[model samples]
Target: MGDVTTIRRDVLTLPVADVGPDNPLPPLCPPDEIHRPDERDGEGLPRDMARQIGYGRLRSLLPERLRDGYGRSRAPRAVDTLVIENDRLRATVLPGYGGRVVSLVHKPGDRELLYRNPVFQPADFALNGAWFSGGIEWNTGATGHSTLACAPVHAARVTAPDGGDMLRLWEWERLRDLPFQVDLWLPDGSDFLYAGVRVRNPHERAVPLYWWSNTAVPEDRRVLAPADEAWHFGPERRLRRVPVPVHGGTDRTYPRRSEYPADHFYELPDGRRRWMAAVDADGRGLVQTSTDVLRGRKLFVWGTGSGGRRWQQWLTEPGTEGYCEIQAGLARTQLEHVRLEGESEVAWLEAYGPLTADAGTVHGTDWAAACSDVEERLERRLPRAGFEEAYKAWRTAADTEPGELLATGSGWGALEVLRAGHSLPGTPFDESALGDAQAPWQDLLRSGSLPEPRRAGPPGETLVAPHWRDLLETAPAHPHTEYHLGVAQWHAGDRAQAVRSWERALGLAPSQWPLLRCLAVADLEAGHRERAADRYTDAFDDLCRERRDDGEAWTAATAALGREAVAALLAVGRTAPARSVWERLRPATRRRGRFRLIEAELLLAEGDRDAARAVFDAGFEVADLREGAEAVGALWSRITDEPLPERYDFRMRPSGGGGA
Candidate 1:
């Protein structure tokens, strides 16, 4: 190394709205829809493109619990951060929060190479329901955002390719029963920050895999990619091939051109280099280039419409610069996942830093020439062979045992190691990582019976993977055992057995709402709408009665389940009961924007159009509103015959306008 590389553990205190605690409710029921619409079969698209569009489906968020316990509440807190720097750039990483790279500063230019979010604010963006707006996010597990977005990952110091201290982050992803690692380093005198990512499937069976390295940068720039055509997926769930740069009669390469959030997945030809860059008016901004293993590159823009800008303000401090995301992924689109075979791994290396191209051509009208200019510059900056050489050199250090643990995440990884009876070598989840939360699982591994909770509290976090399910099945049957066994059975796609187990557990326990909720899903899937509503009503009732302290935790559980319960009731036209459930919610919970939306729906169901319209007139924002949900626009058309107000206009596609 030409200059001494420095690595230090530190704190980054920022104004952050806490993610609070995760919802205690296990995700037993399916979402409203699968949401992935595959219509490409007869489209005569490219063979690889056809194979990659809507390739896999994750039915529900199982194994991982729901994380809906966050809101627009803010405070300042000190976050654990790790700093790594060389002569040209400084990188600040938050190991406690998915090992996200929060900031990358080009020291020579004193310019931030990535969107350094002004504040930390969690929203309902991730698959697990808590996601912040900025930084380079390492996404794994199933799509949307990674389940690890707001969670911790194991972190330690490892040797870099240049023989300096590299920061390594690894974690056991509960959703897929796989372990992954991210190693970050900076070479002496190099302006780029290099990250090597690896996802390993230690299981003996095939697993669906998803990986996306998302980099956020200021949106007031032109994004350049190598492709002349792109796969455009918007909030409308349609994946259509469109001409790059000039889609919908305007240049889509610029983020400001779009009216709402959309994704343009560049269709780089086979055997071409994978890269994308966002350049400012001066043609100087961040560029992210990755090895071939990371096949896809994407540009996600949340445009400057009223609702889009409102969402930006909702996610962070007011008046901060908005950002657009340039992402690299394993598949061609986020709508698809590749098949990861048994006992194999997928790995890639990504480099991110500043790139300056000819400003005039980069912002010119000729799209092909614009892209070629940036490509030429990128090739000169970091040749493909140079990136491959770096990847080969990093592999030698990938298995080097990590030293000096910087932070601790969940004990789940350690528990996995105990069960597998093997070591992951470099990214070891040592026994030291195990804690009180892991006590029951450890006892289950030793004695084959999960220790039943002594308290009447809600069932704690548990595993639903096949191995854990097998252990549970072999144990003596009880309410507790049957309840968990049913969850595992459901996850394994054995609905009949799952229902039978939950039914048995419900009869014995009589008051366990979790079992009732699982049964409700079984009933729903079976087309027993009335039965499902009855079960949902009972589940909500049982949980409400079981609230011991009725504090924030209980309130959260009430709000989450109550929302679901009311929706189910209304689905079956049981508006009376739905209204009753809404009435029973705590006052503070009822005041939430989401609950207000529900209240409006309840009023509309009761033939009170005026009341429902008033809810819209008064204005409310569903902070956790789903990405493609038509709730706001659809509800507006029903309540009043008026144009969809600008503040509530979140539609990304033109199909569903302000109409009924």
Candidate 2:
């Protein structure tokens, strides 16, 4: 080897919008799913696609809390990064932030192959919330961005096939309860950066699997994939088959041509090489190609319209460049999930590098010729046989034990290993990784009961998996056990049992809000608005008293609970008490942008449109305002709308219509 590949520890200092503490409350199953299995599936569906259209049917987000507590305010912070480089290419991986490959540089031309964000700004884009845009993201567990989008992953140096170092990232994805790992290495003198991903379903029963490697490239490029047609899901939220490149009057292959945001999943043929690329006017750009196991290719464009443009600006500093996502997934589309067999794993390899094709050919009006040119270039660069050999080599080296622990992720993986004795050879979840969060659950495993209340902050997060539920059920009956057991039961769809367990827990304890909040949610769902408000009011008051002297963790908890309580009271037409709860909030907490919006809503409920408009006029950005949420626009329309102010227009879909 002329130039030895290197893996080193590094830091990237940037203005990072803090991803604040997670909400302490649990989110139950929605009354109905956005897509139902019984509904006639989208036309030309693939096998098992219909079944997976509703993979989240009857789903609950219990163990994972919503992370909507981030803001636009950012300060310089040193984010830890792992750098793996060869003479030709340099790859920077953020192991602390979901193992996201934050940057890839092609050294020959000194070109950045990815659109690296200038700032680490958190927004309401992830499944559990607080997601930042840029780089190559590992999307797993569901249709939306992974719960691990901003969370860490276990990382360590492992042996490469050529005996050099490789960075391996592994984590237990809680939403689907599976362990997955990604191995990244660069061969000596190779320009391509290779990533090998493995997702293991350790359960005895089969489970749905979702994996997508999302790569972001500059928006001002022509994207090409090996297909003549695509499954287009637009802001209108309807799926239809359309011609590649040009649809309607413009060519969407260039991301900015469209007026609204959309996803175009390329309809690759039965045996086409799996790849996606974005080539610039000079026909030089990044190309991401994966092994056959990773079959899907897609392009997500945030159109050049106001909302889309605003969203692009929102994810980074104002002057930073914009980007579009060229993604590869296990299924034909992100809307579908593949069925993974029990105790089995799916593994694939992906290569990302610079692609320089003929500018005229790639930018030509003939879509077929453009795609063929890129595909032929890709074949010349990385032959299918060579790619297959590399995959096989990676498979053989996958089992090599990690040499050094570089970074540690969540303790849930180790907790799972201790609970079920999962023998994941390549990716080890060492017991040392277990920390404070997992301590109570580990004690439950060891001593058959939870540890005493660790001071009256918000209740330690609850686990609602079936196995954890069984343990909770067997633990001696007490307020703590009953409270957690209720959460478990609720997750299992046993509504009556869950309510009774919570009631018993409240009976055993003196007005704990954790238990009360769950009961309040149940009441709200059951059309008991007044009763829900009553419970919510009591819960807010109790939490205020309990977390009086606690710090920011409790501060986050109080803010979350207070918001919920106010919303419940307002829904029940009890503005007086809602105002009371709002007043009781910490001044700083009430001043948050989210709370400002809530205050505006409350003022509007009190028939004070001028006050509500003033709240809007004073100019506050709900930093974590949800994607596609009409909350801001709806309030603007109600408060004497002047065309829904362009500054606050974050709408992705068409306005003035029913939307999901």
Candidate 3:
């Protein structure tokens, strides 16, 4: 047989002999006639009665009390049996529970099984099962009440080639004699699977309960949840970044692909539900599943990123590919009736199948196509939306109190809207109309809001804030704001103002390493070696702490800061201290191409010309790592005692010899 084939019939074919008469056949088993032991000699007198049994004694093993409890007292009994015969496999499904076959088999040859009952162990549930530990607890003293709550929870399971005998089962006892119901299914046969729950108020009196799905999957997997926005929380659990709506509307979607590794809990938009898929890159077929349709279900996706967060292992396996499962239920609560009621409605699922490797690629392409179509529809609808009226309002807003309205925070929205307007084929706001907001425009330019700040004359010259000073004043103060303001002041020949701004920033929040480094350099320029040394110490301390806290961010920040620090220290004859700091930093931080030249400088300072030459030689081996234009110019200045290169030239061509 070829590697790929599609079977036409819903039922699969299985080898009869492969199945164990004592145990249930796998879901994938194909159907065919096979020999059996003595027919009915054990219970009945008939000798031919046993040859037709497919699931063997499994059908009889299900407790009759359990079956009666699941249905009406006098309802017609339904046959729950697995049959294998004539190259076709079949299982009888009961009607009461959505007519779903709780136990299903594919072909006899297929080794996948739909359900199995494994012995329960608390330790196994604690360590291997999901929803056993650290979840919201609920207890109802035979009093039925309905309540819904939400809490962060986790669950996991491992499926290997061996241990087919082990199976997982969960049971919920009714406290208030309310109807306990659950809908479980493996919707996707690949990488991800999900279970959804819904609780109904069967009784006239209200019920309360706490519920959650402690769902777990193999470590080292990733999750994809549909999100319209995201939020960031700092170490203190304080809101770092507010929920910023994913810029593209719901219709304007992008492939939910992550460029960087992360594990985070993303909330879906209110009123709209979303599905999540867990993926293992190295797995065979994607194990996908989803929740059953219920009156109300809230979806959530939580996992870790490539970074070493506690939950990252669930989303990403260390050496091998992993798996992920989605658990859906009522939120979390503490009340007894509430917990019991919630448990009645809890949903769980398990799926084992090979995942298609190119599923993500296919899904991503489809998303892109859909988004393009949506954008086109939006574009067609724009002409009828009274664009002229909106443009007039925008222009009016831009004219009056132009500075305040176009200030830092306010202008960002307006800027985005205005840019969007420009992209449209027929926009009401003419270029000249946009230019009419010049006062606000000048305010932004004067405040250094533009990408590049305007240059000013020599030192000691009288200076004034640009025409848009009010607009600049309205902009919020961020860490970079003061730094940029200082740069503007320096260019305008107000050295004192620049220094004061930097100092003010440092006083406000001393842990800002970039500002500290800048302050240190300014001190060095002013011949304040002692002050510079103190500033350097502060910067080094903050960076070192950050490095120890998070290696990646620390490496990035250090690489950027270390280069400047090395140069400044060398200028101030503090090579020894600089060298010591460099040593403490990670090798990844120093091996950057930019640092190679710095290494040469440090060697030259130590009077090791050969070592410096070797560093330069290594740098030359990488074509792009050759000495930067500004560095060469600096060397020429040192050799010939010529005037320094122009500021604009220096800025335009920076020494790009740094590690990233």
lDDT of 1 by residue, 236-352 (tens): 666788999897899999999998778898989988888899999999999999899998899999887666776777777678999899999998888777899998988889999
State which candidate, 2 or 3, has the greater TM-score.
Answer: 2
TM per candidate: 0.94, 0.97, 0.27
* Candidate 2 residue pairs in backbone clash: none
* Top candidate (lDDT): 2
lDDT of 2 by residue, 1-660 (tens): 356899999999999988988877777654222222224444556646655675654367668888877888889999999999989999999998899999999998999999999999998888878899999999998777888989989999999988888999999999888999999999888889999999998989988888889999999999999998898886556667789878897898999798889999888898889899999999999999989999889999999888898899988877888899999998777888788999999999999999999999999887788888998999999898899999999999888889899999999999999999999999899999999889999999999997667556677788988999999999988898898899889989899999999999887675489888999999987899899999999999888777766477788888888999999999978999999999988898888888999999999999998999999899888887777666777778777836777778887877633211
Cα lDDT of model 3 by residue, 1-660, tens digit? 221111111322211111001111001111111112223223431122122121221111110001100100122222222121122222222221121232233333442222211111011111001111111122111211111101111111211112111111111222222222222222112111112232332333444433333233433333334443333221112212223223223211121232211223334444332233334453221232222221111222222322222122211222423223333333211111123332223322322222323444423534434323322332343321332343333222221211111001112213322433322111122232233223334445445452222221011111122322233334555434565455445444566876777677676653456567767767876888767776776777677764444333345456545655666677767878778666766685466444665776787776677776566445321111111123633432333343432321221112222100
Query: Residue 258 deviation, candidate 2, in Å?
Result: 0.5
**Candidate 3: worst-modelled 10 consecutive residues by lDDT:** 63-72
Number of clashes recorded per candidate: 0, 0, 69
After superposing candidate 1, which stretches have Cα over 4 Å from the reference? Answer: 31-35, 38-42, 52-55, 657-660
List the RMSD of every prediction in angstroms: 2.3, 1.9, 30.6
What's the CA error at residue 190 for candidate 1, in Å?
1.0
